[model samples]
Target: MLYFCPASVRVRAASGAALKPIQSINAHPSNCICIKFDPTGKYFATGSADALVSLWDVEELVCVRCFSRLDWPVRTLSFSHDGKMLASASEDHFIDIAEVETGEKLWEVQCDSPTFTVAWHPKRPLLAYACDDKEGKYDNNREAGTVKLFGLPNDS
Candidate 1:
């Protein structure tokens, strides 16, 4: 398992009597806000306030790739169920989806407000995110919060 601290990512053995650190990586220059393991457990991704996302090899404990596109702090990250893509939500009102292997940006969309969270459907090509509407229109309505869903194009 992995633990994401302010500026580090620690790998721990989950089966041990006590979770002991196997390795630790100083992953980000600023606070690391989110970490997620891919579905296959072969790789993990970390998002930081320094406007960067890092992909790491689980066994090698080394960074395989770094994605630097966001101009604001990243708030959340989610990997597709197939583990081939990664999605990041940032405080700058944008969300980006990228190909995991090549760090190629698949697409990006701007939201009306800063996004707080993002998730990909476990069995489909649908992406969802929630935003914090500072305007208070959605919040005051007491309706469902500012949540949006997007359907991705077929890979073929």
Candidate 2:
């Protein structure tokens, strides 16, 4: 199964060689920029230019909750190894982490430039992130491009 989009997202069943579109959804007010599925595939998420991330239940095929901690267009999204924590990155100077089940923001990690990507360790709670300002697109891109690891625990 896949959830993808431009301004809207489509639910597709990717069981065979051909991609058969199952459904189309105007999932976001603005363009949907990125999407990610949790490790279990029971849940998936959509990040948008609206600066919001929408969580969807794979079974019910509906939005279960939303994360709106970012003020800039959401650039990336990733779920923790256990799929209990979700991290969102954007043009903002901070990357926001949210508790998947409760929709509560866990914390934010401050960075020197716009965050471009985030990946959770498959077996650990560590999160790896990258930042860049390619062509000086943002004013905070003083560090060039760097990737860093953060061992942020779910409890803290």
TM per candidate: 0.86, 0.85
Distance from true location, Cα of 84 in model 2, Å: 0.4
Report how far residue 103 has shifted in candidate 2, in Å: 0.8
The positional error of residue 56 in candidate 1, measured at the CA in angstroms, is 0.5
Top candidate (lDDT):
2
Model 2, global lDDT? 0.84
For TM-score, the strongest prediction is 1
Clash number for each model: 0, 0
User: How high a TM-score does candidate 1 get?
Assistant: 0.86
- What lDDT is obtained when candidate 1 is compared to the true structure? 0.81
- Per-residue lDDT of candidate 2, residues 1-156 (tens digit): 574758344444454457666666567878888999999888999898889999998877799999988999999999999999999999999889899999998878888778989999999988899988554445454655667788855434
Q: Which stretches of candidate 1 lie over 4 Å from their true place?
A: 7-15, 134-144, 152-156
